[model samples]
Target chain A: MIFTRSTLMVLLLTVTFGVSFALLSPIFTDAQLEQKTFVTHSGRVIETSGEVLDPVYTVSTVDFDPDEFLRNFEYGRISISDNGQTIRDYTIIAEDDKVQEISPGVFFNVWTFNGTVPGPTIRATEGDLVRIHFINNGSKSHTMHFHGIHPAEMDGVFEIVGGNGGQFTYEFEAGPVGVHPYHCHVMPLEEHIVHGLYGVFIVDPKEGRPPADELVMVLNGFDTDFDTENNFYAANTIPFYYQHHPIQINTDQLIRIYVVNMVEFDPINNFHLHGNLYQYYPTGTDLVPSFYTDMITLSQTERGIMEFQYDYPGKYLFHAHKVEFSEKGWVGLFLVKDNSTSEAYYGN
Target chain B: METSEKTSRIKVVTSGIIPFVFVVLMVAYIFGPGADLLDLGVPLPELTIEKIAFEKSEIHVTVRNTGPLPVQVVMADVNDRIHPAAIEPDKFLNRYETALVRIPFEWNEAEPYTIGLTTDDGTRFERNIDAAAPALQMNFEFVVFFAIIGTYVGIIPVMIGLLWLPFIKKISKSKYHFFLALTVGLLLFLGIDSIEEAFDVSLENLGGSFNDVLLIATTVVLSFLGLYYVSEKLTGRADSLRISKPVVIGLMIAIGIGLHNFGEGLAIGAAVGLGSIAFSTFLIVGFALHNTTEGLAIAAPMSRGKLMIGKLITMGIIAGAPAIFGAWVGGFAFSPFSSVVFLSIGAGAIFQVIVIILKWIREEGDKNLSSAAVAAGFATGMFVMYATSILI
Candidate 1:
C-alpha cells in the first residue's frame, strides 16, 4: 500500500539494477577497496591517510610527571638549532636495584643503566662525534653493545669491564640518522636484556627533519620468575605508566615517535597506532620512508621513527599490537588537543 | 451468434475451475500435507548427503537452516528410528546457517535414505536424499561463493533500515519520541550488557585489581567526557548543561550501536570459521532482531527534519556496515582480547549516548514530557530486547 505507482516502478528498476550490479561487481571491483588484500611481508595498512584540517600553532606546556622515572625521562628533538655543535658527550652507570613491584606487587631484581631501566636517550645529528663514558658500579661485569655503526674497541664487552666502579670512555661518530638501541652485550644476552639494561639512541638526520613533537619509546619486559619468558612488558620500564600520565601532543603538528624493542625473551613485538597511520622510516636510516602504515613489527633491537599529524583532538592509543603485551602493560595514550584549550592536567 | 455464446461459456468454466484449484492448492500447502513448503513462522531444517568417501566410515550430512528463525537441532533419525550416530549433542542450526553434520552410517551407493531433522521447536522436516546426487564439494570457488552469501546475509539489517526510511515521515512527533525513549531503553540494556561482559573479562583475567578496575572506569569516564567536549565544541558552547545538537546525538547513537554490532559480527564470523555453525546461526537471528530495534533509534530523531535520501542511506551504512566488516576480519583472524577491547569501547560510547538522551528528554520541557509514557516505552524496549535475546 505504501508503494505508489512511480515508487513501485523505481523499486523494480532498482532491484533489476542492483542484481545486475551484484553480478557484475567482480569485474568492476577494484582489488584495493572492493577486495580484501592481506600483506604478509609488509606491515598492515589500517588507515590510508590523515589530513590536518586546521592549523593552529601556539606554545603550550605539558607536564610529564608520573613517577620519578617518568618525570626524569627525556623526549623531543635535540636542540641542534646551532649546528655548530660538533661533539656529543654522555655517561651511563650500570647498577643493580631491587624493585618492590614491577606491576603492582610483582617484584623484580633489575639491572639498570644510570639508575633507570632504559637509560637517558642520547640524541645527536648525523656525522656528529659521540663520546660515552661507561661505568659499572654493580658487582657483575656489564658492557654496552650498541646496535649501530661503531668500532669494536668502544664496544662494551666483558673483557673491558673493570667490575665494580670500573670506567671506560668510548668515542665514535653518530652517522646514518636512525633510532638505535644500546643494551648489555654480556654472554647471557637474553638474561641481561630482560633485567633492563637497554636504552634508545636517536641520531637526527643531517639537514634535520622538520621539527615536531618528538618522543622516545623503548619496549622492554621483565622476567620476574627467572624463566626465559617475560611476565611483564613496558614501553619505558613502567607498567601502565602512560595510562596514568598520558603523553600530550598539540594538534596541527606532526608527531615523531622513536620506538625500540629490546625484550630479549620475546621473539617479536609490534606497535599499532590507533586512528592514525605514520610515515615509517625504518631505523631512521633512510632519507625516504619505506612505507606508511598504522602497525609495524620489530624484532629484538629493531628501531624506527614514525611521523604523522593528527587532524582531530582525542586520546589516541599507541601500543603493541600484541594483545597479551597490551593487556599486561605495553600500552600508552597520546592525548592530543588544541594549544589554546589543553593544559597540563597531571601537573609535573 | 450461437458459436460465440458457446465459446464464452467454455471460457467461464475454464477460469472458475482454475481459480478453485489454485485456492485449494494454496490452502493445502499452507495448512496440510504441504505445510513444510511454507514453514510458517517456524524453523525448517533440511538435510542433504554432501560427500561419501570410502574407508571414512562416516557420511557427511549437510544440515541447513532454511527458515527465518534459528532452530536448536535436537536429533536426526534415519527411517523414523532413533539413531545415536545421526544426532549431535548440543547442536543448533541458525537461519541460513549450515553445518556439516557427520553421521556414523555406512553409505550404500545404491540405497536412498530418508533423513528426518527434528528441531527443539517440535517441527520436523524430512528429505529423501540420494547419496550420490552430485555430492557437495569444497573448493576455493565455493569458499568465495559462501563468503559472498555470508556478507549478503550479514548486512541485511542495514538494507532493511535503508528501505524503512521513506515511511518515517508518517510517524507523528509524539510517536517518534516514544520510539526514541524506547531506543534509549534498549541502548541502556545494550550498554549495561556490554559493560557487564567487559567486567567479566576483567574479573576473570585482570584479577580485579585497582588498575584493572580503574582501567574500565576511566575508559567510560573518558569516553563520556571526550564526546561531551566534542559536542560542546560543535555547538560552540562552554556550558555543560547545553543540550547536544540532535544530529550530533543521532550520529553518536549510531556509532555506538555500530561498534556493538561489529563486535557481534566478529563473534558470528569467528564462530562460523570454527565450525560452530549453530551458534553463529543463533547469533544472526538474535542480532538481526536487535538491529531492527536499533534502526529505529537512528531514524527516530531525524523525523522532525526532511533529510535527504542520500544522507539517510549514509547514516544507515555508518550504523550497519561494521557488522559485515567485523565478520570479514573475524572469519580470517579471531582474537578474544581484541573483541574485549571493541566491546569495552562500545560500552563506553553507548553510555555517553544514554546520558545525552536523558538531557534531551529533560530539555523537551514540561508539557511534552510524559514520565509514565517514557517509563513504559523504556520497559517495553528492555522487554523486547530481553525476549529476543532468549531465542538465541
Candidate 2:
C-alpha cells in the first residue's frame, strides 16, 4: 500500500501510543476493583463467601484456643538424682520478640517463656530438685526467678543472663509447698511482667491432694498503648476469650482452680463467682481451708487454690469484682453439664 | 609421565573438593550465623480507615493495611458493643491491601458513633464519626439542592458578567483588539489557577502511591491536544454560514470557563458533604462575585462579531451548567483522583482558548506585539479577577 510520509508517521505514532497506553493503564486504574486470590503462607488458597466489600478484610485462619491452656500443666522430665533424690529437668526458652495476638486484631510483642504469654505452668512435688535449663533466644537479657526458696546464686535477679543465645541453669529445691509465680526477674521487673513473662509454679506436698478436675487461671493485663495503665484484662492472655467460649465442666465433680494474679500497674484484683461459694486456700501452703467466700481480693502475684462442686447443671459467670476490669474483658462463664444425662443443657 | 599423572589426579581431586567446599559455604551463608545475624524483629501492622459509608442500618467501612505485615480483621465493634460484620474478599490483608467491612448497625442520625475494628493481633483501630448521616443518594431532594447551589455559584454569576457585552461592542475599532488581549490575560490567570487548585487537591487528599503529579500532568497534556484537534476541525468549517472563527473561539472560552467552574463547584459541594464547611448565603454571594468575571472573559472574544441574543445565552449556559453536574458528583461521591483530573483538563482547555485568541489578535493586523492599550487591558483583566477572588 502506497502512503504519504504524514500518513506513515501517524500510523507509527498510533501503534506506539496504543502499546504504551495498554501497558500503563493498569497503573492508573484502582487495584481494589480487581478480584484477586492470594496464597497464604501455609500454601492454602482461601475462598470467601458472602458479599465482599470494595476491599475485602483479610481473615486469619490461625486461632489461639484457650481451652487447652486451662487444663495444661508442664511437669517436666522426671528422673532419679545420683544421691537418690528426685530431679525434674525443665527447658524454658525466653524470647523477647514473639508477636502474639492477645485479642482479635491486637498484636503485641510478648516476651515469652516457651513461646506463650503467662508461659507454661510448672508443677513439682515438695523437696524435688527442680532444674530449669533456661535459654535466652530473645533480644534482651532475662533470668528465671522463682518466688519460692532458692540459693542466693540461684536467684534470677543477681546473675543477669546476656541476650541472644545466653544460657542459665537454675537448680533449686521446690520448697514451701504452695502455688508460686516464676517470671523473668530482669531489672525493671514490671516491664518484663506486663509483657507476659510470668507463669504459675505449683509445688505439691510429699503426698498429693485428692483427685479433682484441676485447672490453671492466670490473671493478667495488657497495656497496649504503653500508658502505664492496662487497656484490657483477662484470665488468660486474650480478652473476653473465655466469655465467648465458655469453659465446660461436669456437675457434681470437685473443681480445683489454681488462681494466680500477675496484673501489673494495678494495686489489687479480685475474682467473684456468680451463684457459688468455695473453700479457698490463701496460698495452697496448707491443706486446710483458709476461708469460704464467693469473692476474694488478691495483690500482685498472690495465688490460691479453690475447691468447689456445682450440684446443678447450668451456666455460671465468673469475673473480676473490679467493675473496670470486668467491663474491660476480665470475664468468663463456666458451663457445668450433668454427667447423669446424655443431653447437654446450655444456659444463657 | 608419573609426575604428569599425579598432577592430573590432584587437579581432579581439587575440582571435587572445590564444589563440595562451595556447597558447604553457601549452605552456611544462607542458614547458619548469617541468617541469625540478619534477624529483624516482628513486622508491625498498621491499619488506616479510608472511607466510611453510612447506609440504612449499615455502616460500610473501607480500610487499608499501610504496614509491611499482614493483618486480619477478626472482629467489629460499634460503641464498644461487638457486632458481627461480613468482610469482603477475605479478612486477611497483605501490605497495601484494602478491605470493605459491612457492619449491620442501627445508628441514629446526628448522634456520634465510634466504629472499631479488631485485628487478629488484638490491635484495635477505631474511627469516629462526629455526626452520623446517611451517605448521599441520587434522590429528588439531592438533585434540587445541588442544582440550587450550582445556579448560585456558576450560572447566575456568568450571566451577570455578560452584562459587559454592550459596553465592549460600543468601543472603537482601534481599542477592539485590547479587549481580546484582556480576554487572553483573564484565561491565562484562570488556567494557572486551575492547575494550582488541582495540585492542592492532589497533595492533600491523594495517597503518595498514586503519583498525582504525573497523573495531573498527563491529563493536562491530553486535554490540550484534544481541544486543539477539535478547534482545527472547526477552523475547516469556518467558511460555512452556521459558525464563524470568532464565534468558535468564544465557544471555546465558554467551555474552558465551564470546566473551571465545575471544579469550583466540586470543592464547595465536597466541603458541604464532609460537613467541614457550612452552606450559607454569604458563601454563595462570595462565589457569585468570583465567577462573574468569567462571563466577561467569554464575551470579550465575540465583541466584533455579529451579535445574536440566542447564541449569547447558549454560550452562557454552555459555560455555566457543568457546575451542577460537578456539585452532584462532589456531594455524593467525591473522589480526589477524579477531581485532580477534571481540574487539569480545565486548565488545559483554558490555555488552548488563550492561544487561539492571541493568534486572532495577530491576524487582525496589530503587528506590534506589545501595545500600551493591550498591556493596560491585560493588567486590568488580571486585577479584576484578583479583586473578585478576595470576596470568595
Candidate 3:
C-alpha cells in the first residue's frame, strides 16, 4: 500500500510538472524570439518585442504601379484596313514635364510617353499595319523611333515633332517577329531615353509561339542628383515596388516575361532568377529557345523574352545580377502559389 | 534780451537760406546736361530665379527683377524648344518686382532643364535646374517632426531647468539679488547675440535688395519701444492686484527668452530643411543643453514669489512654445527678411527685459549696481551661456 501510494504521488507530480513545463516553454521561447533590435540607416536604434517591421510599402507619390505595368499590353484600337490588313492604331503622347518620386524622398522629372516613365507597352502581330498618331504635348521635341525594319520616312529620326501640341503620324509594317524598344529619337538621345521616353514594343509571330502568362519588365535607372550617374534602379519606374508587392504566380504554370533594358549612363544591367531556370529567347526573334539559364546580362536597349515554370510553390527573388543596381532598388520577389490549393490565384 | 532775440532770428534765417540755395542748385543741375548723363542707356534686365517648383504638368518659376530698368518677358523656352507660358502679375517686371512664370511643360524628374526667358530685346535670361526635384510641401508629418524637434530643444530642456526652482527658493536673501543680477547678465548676452545673428543673416542671405544695417536698427528700435509700452501697461494692471514686482519681472524674462528661443529654432529648422545640417543625436542634445539656461533665467526672479506649479508651467510654455512656430516657418517657408526681422525683435525684447530686471534689482535696496555678489553672478551667467554654446 505504501509503494502504490508513492508511485501515485510520483505520477501525479510528474504529470503536473510536464504540463507546467509545456505551458511555460512557449512563453520563454516566444519572448526570446520576439525581442528584436534594429538599427536604421540614419543610426537610430530601435528595440521592440512586438512586431518591428518597417512598413511593407510606402505610399508612392507617383501613381505608376509596377504590377499593373507588368501585364498591361496595349493592343491599341484594332481595326480592319481597306486591304483587309490588321491595323493597330495607337496615339503616343510625349510629355516632358512630369515629376516622379523614383525612390523614397527622391524625386525626378521624368520625360514620358503617355505620362509614364516606360510609357505604354505597344503590342502588334507580324505583318500588321502599325499606325501611331504621335503627339508632342511636352516642352521639348520628341519622336517615336521603333527598332525594326521600316521605311526611312517612317523612322522616328529626322522627323522632329515640335513641342507644345506638335503632331505627326508614323505608319509602318510590323515585320520583325520580336520584342523591340520604341523611344524618342531626337538629338541628345541619351537625355530623352534616360528621362523615361522609352517603352516596349512586342511584335508577335503571325502563328503565335505559345500561350502563357505574359509580363513586361522594363529595367531602368534614375540620376536623381544629375551627376551623370544613376542613383536608383528598378524593373519598372519606381524603385523597390515589386519587393513590397510581390508578383503572384501559380506553381507549374509557364511564365513569359518580356524584359527590356533602357538604363543609360551605365555599361550593362542584368537579371537573375532565384531557384529556377528559364528558356531565354534573345529578343524573342526566333520561335525556338536559344538558351536555358537563370540569368542574362543586357546592354542599353538590349532585350529578350524569358519563359519559365516553377516546380515548387514558394517565394522567389528576381533582381539585377549587378550588385550595385540590385542594392539600389532593383530587386523583386515572386510568390509562387500551389495551384491545387487555390485555382483563383491572380498572377501579377 | 533784445540782442538775444535778434541773434536767434538771424540763426533761423541762415538755416532757411541753406535749404533754398541747395534746392536752387539741384534744380539748375537737373536742367543742365548733368541730369542727362545720369540716364546710363537701357540697363540690362537682371532676372534672378528665386524658386523653381514642379507641380503636375507645369513648372512654376518664381523670378525677381533686381535691375534698374523694367523687363518684359515675351517668350519662354524649355530645353531650347519654345513653349507657351503664363506669367502671373504680368510679365512686365519693374525693379525689385517678382513674377511667377507658369510654363505648361511636362518636365521629367532627375533631368536637367534650362528654363529660358526671352526679353523684349531678344536678350535671354536662363535658369538651369541641375536636377528637377519636387517642391517641399507642408504636410502633417512635417509639422509633427518639427514639433518633436521643438519639444526636444525647447520645452523639455526648459522644464528640466525649471526643476531648479526649489533650490533657488532656498537661497539666502543676499544671494537672491545675485540670481537677479545673473538673470540680467543672461538677457544682456542673449540680446547682443541675437543682434549679431540678425546682422549675420542680413549680410549673408538678404542680398542687395535690403539695406540690412538700416533694417536691423529700425526693427530693433521699434520692437524695444513696443515691448516697453506693453510691459508698462502690464505693470499698471498688476499693481492693482498687488502682485509682487518680482513676479512681473519674471514673466517679462520668460517672454524675452521665448523670443530668443524662437530665433534659435528658426536657425535649426532652416539648417535641417536645407539639408546643410544633419539631424543627429548630438545636435538635439546640444540644443537642449544650450536652452536649459534660458529656463533658469526665467525662474531666478520668481524665487521670491509664491511659486505655483501652474504658474511655473505657464511661464515655461510661454518661454518655450514659440520655438515650435519658428521651426514650422523656417522649415516650410523660410524668408531671410522675416528671419532678420524676428531676430531683431528678439534682441529688442531681451534688452527691454534687462532694463526691467535692473530696475527691480535697484528697488530691492541695492541702490547702486556695485555689489560683489552681483558682479560675480553676472560673470557666471555669461560664462555658463558661452560654455553651453560650445556644445551646439
Candidate 4:
C-alpha cells in the first residue's frame, strides 16, 4: 500500500511538472524569428532578340551527358533565367529523361521531359504569358496541352502536329491566377507522357502572392531506365534535383507557398507539411486567411497555393503524403529558425 | 517495446457515468469565464527554428521512426536561414526521413562553428555539426517517442476504463477480439492511407527518384500486405486445417513483409540522397503500420505459446524489424529496385489478406451479417472526405 501510494504521488508530480512546463513554453515572438522581404515583380524569358537560344541542351537531366556534349539530346530543361534573375527551369524532351539518380526509372515508348516523365512544377502567375518555343527534337509527333488552364488554339491538345525536328511557339495568355499542369497530349498519351513530357503551371493569385514570404516550387518525375538508381516508376517521375532542394523557414514569420503538380500523368499528389498547417486555395482559387492545414492533396494536372503564419517556431519538415514516394524520391523540406522575443527568458 | 506491453494492460469501465462528467467539464470549461485556462490547450512554444543552416558548414541529421503511428515533420530551426520558408508544407514527413541540412558554406577562411538539427514535432533536436576537418559528416538519430504517445492513447484509456468497470468483470474473449479488430482497423487504415498518403508526392515540374521510387515502393508495400492477407485466408484457419508446415507459412509471411519494407527503405534512401527529410518520414510510417499489423497477426496465432512474451516479441520483430531495417536503409543505403521487389512482395501479402476476407464473406453470407452497419461505416468514411473537401 505504501509503495502504491508513493508511486502514484511520484507519477502525479512528474505529470504536473511536465504539463506545466509544456504550458509555460513561450510563444514565438517577432523578435525571435527571422523575417524576409516579399518582393514580386515582372519577369520575362523571351528569345525575341534571338541573341542566344540560351543554346541550352533541351534534354532530360538524367540523360544530360556532362562528359559528352548534348548531341541528339533525348530530353532536358531549358535553363533560361527569368529576366536573368531566376533560372526558369523548363522541360524540353523525353526518352532520355530521368528519375532520381539512386532509383533511375526510364519509360520507353514515350516522350517527356528530362527529370520526371510528367515533368516538374511549371509555375506562373495571372496575366503572365506562358510562352513556349519548342524545337521538336523527338522522333515522332508531339504537342503541349494545358490541363489546368484553357486555350482556344494551342491548348496543345493532340490536335497539333509536332513532328521530328520541327518547332512551334506555344503561347498562352495567362488565365486566372491558379495552379495549372501542362502535358504532352499526343497519340498514346499514356506512352508519350508516361515516358516523359510534362510540367506544372502555377498562376499566382490575381493580386499577387500573400503578404507572407513567397516560395514557388515545381515538382515532377523522371524516367531514366538504365541508371539503376531510379527505375521503379514506369511513367510519371519526380527528378532528383527537386528532392535535392531543402525547404527552410522562419518560425516567427508568415509563409506563402505555390506548389504545382507537373507530372504529365500519374499518382494522387498529396503535399503535406510536418508540425505546421497552411491556409490554402482549393481548386487553386479563393484564398481565405483561415484555410490552414499541413496537408494538401493535388490531383493530376492540378495546382495549389498555401499561406499561413507561424506562431511557434521549431524544426519542421515538409514532403509528399505518400509514404513510399520519398523513398522513390518525391520530397522537399523547410527549416524553421529560432524566433525568440528576448534572451531574458532562456538566458541565451 | 515498452508502450506496446503497457497498452495491453488497459481496461475501461464507467459506472460513474463518465459521460456526465465529460459534459460537466465541457460546460465548465467552454462556458465558464476561465475557459481558456481550464481547457486542454496550453501556450504554444515561441522558439521558431527557421533558415537555420550551417551557414558556415555542412550538417547531416537523420530523424528516425520510434512511434506507434506516423507523424508529420516540417522545417526545423538551427540550420535554417533561407530568404523564404516553406513551413507547414501541405504534407507530412513520415517515419525515418533524414536530411543533411547543409548551408553549403564555402570556407575561404577557417572558423569555429556548430550546426543545429531539428525534428518536425517541435522537438528541438540538434547536433554539433562540423565540416571543416576533412568533411566530417555529423549524424543525428531521431527518437521515435512512440512509447510516450502510446502511454496516452492506449494505457491511459484502458486504465481509466478499468477503474470504473467492475473488478470482477474481466475482459471477455469476444471483447478482446473486438478490441483487436478495432486496433487492426485503425492500423490497417493507417497502413493503407499512410502508404498512399506517404508516397503520393506531387512536386511542380521536377520529378524523378523522389516520386517514382516512392510511388512504386508504397504500391508494393500495399500489394504485399494485400497478398499476404489473401494468402492467409486461402490457407484456411488453425482450427480445421492441418497445414503441413504452419511455421514455414508464418515465416514466409514474415519474410514477404520484410522484403516489402526493404523497398520502402530504398525509397527513403533515394529521398535522403536528394536531401529530402520529409518524404523519408512517410516511408517510416508506412513501414510502422506494416510492422504493427504484422505483430498483431502473429500474436493472434501465438496466443498460447511457451513464453508468450518471447513469442510476441519475436513476432513483433518479424513484423517490425523489417521497418527498422528499411528505415536504416532508407536513411542510409536504400535503392529503387528494392522498392520493386518489395512492391511485388507486398502485393502478394495484400492478395493473401483479400483472399481471406473474401472466403470468409462467401462462407457466411447471412450469418451475423450487418449490411446496414457496413454500409453506414462506408458512408461515414465517404461523408468525412466530402465534408472536408467541401469545407476546403
Return the top candidate by TM-score: 2
* Poorest 10 consecutive residues by lDDT, candidate 4 chain A: A49-58
Better of 1 and 3 by TM-score: 3
User: Please, what's the RMSD in Å of model 2?
Assistant: 11.3
Interface RMSD of 2: 10.3
Compared with the true structure, what per-residue lDDT tens digits does model 3 show for residues A97-186? Answer: 887655543446889999888999999999999999999999989999999999999898999999999999999999799999999999
DockQ of each: 0.00, 0.15, 0.01, 0.01
Candidate 4 or 2, higher DockQ: 2
The C-alpha interface RMSD of every prediction is 25.6, 10.3, 28.2, 19.0
lDDT of 3 by residue, B88-191 (tens): 55666777666667666667876888876655444556767666655546889889988988888888888888888888999886687788788777778888
Question: How well does chain A score by TM in each candidate?
Answer: 0.73, 0.81, 0.83, 0.57
lDDT of 1 by residue, A188-265 (tens): 777777777888777877788876666777888766545576655778766557755677777777777788888777
Order of all candidates by lDDT, from best down to worst? 2, 3, 1, 4
Off by over 4 Å in 3: A1-348, B1-61, B73-89, B101-134, B277-283
| Colliding pairs, model 1 | none
lDDT of model 3 at residue B216? 80
Model 1, A263: alpha-carbon shift in Å? 1.5
Give per-residue CA lDDT, model 2, range A114-217, as digits (tens): 98888889999999999999999988999999998999999899999989999999999998898999999997888988998999999988888887888899
- Per-residue alpha-carbon lDDT of candidate 2 for residues B1-392, written as tens digits (9 for 90 to 100): 99999999999999989999999998989787689765779766677665677887678777767667777876666675455566775687776566777776677877888887767665667778777767877789988999998988889988988888899899875577777777777778888888998988776555455567787787777778777766766776777747877788888889888998888888777766755454434456677787787888777777767887788888888888888888887888776657887898899898888878777777773566477767877787787777766676
Native interface contact recovery, all models: 0.00, 0.24, 0.00, 0.00
TM-score of 1: 0.37
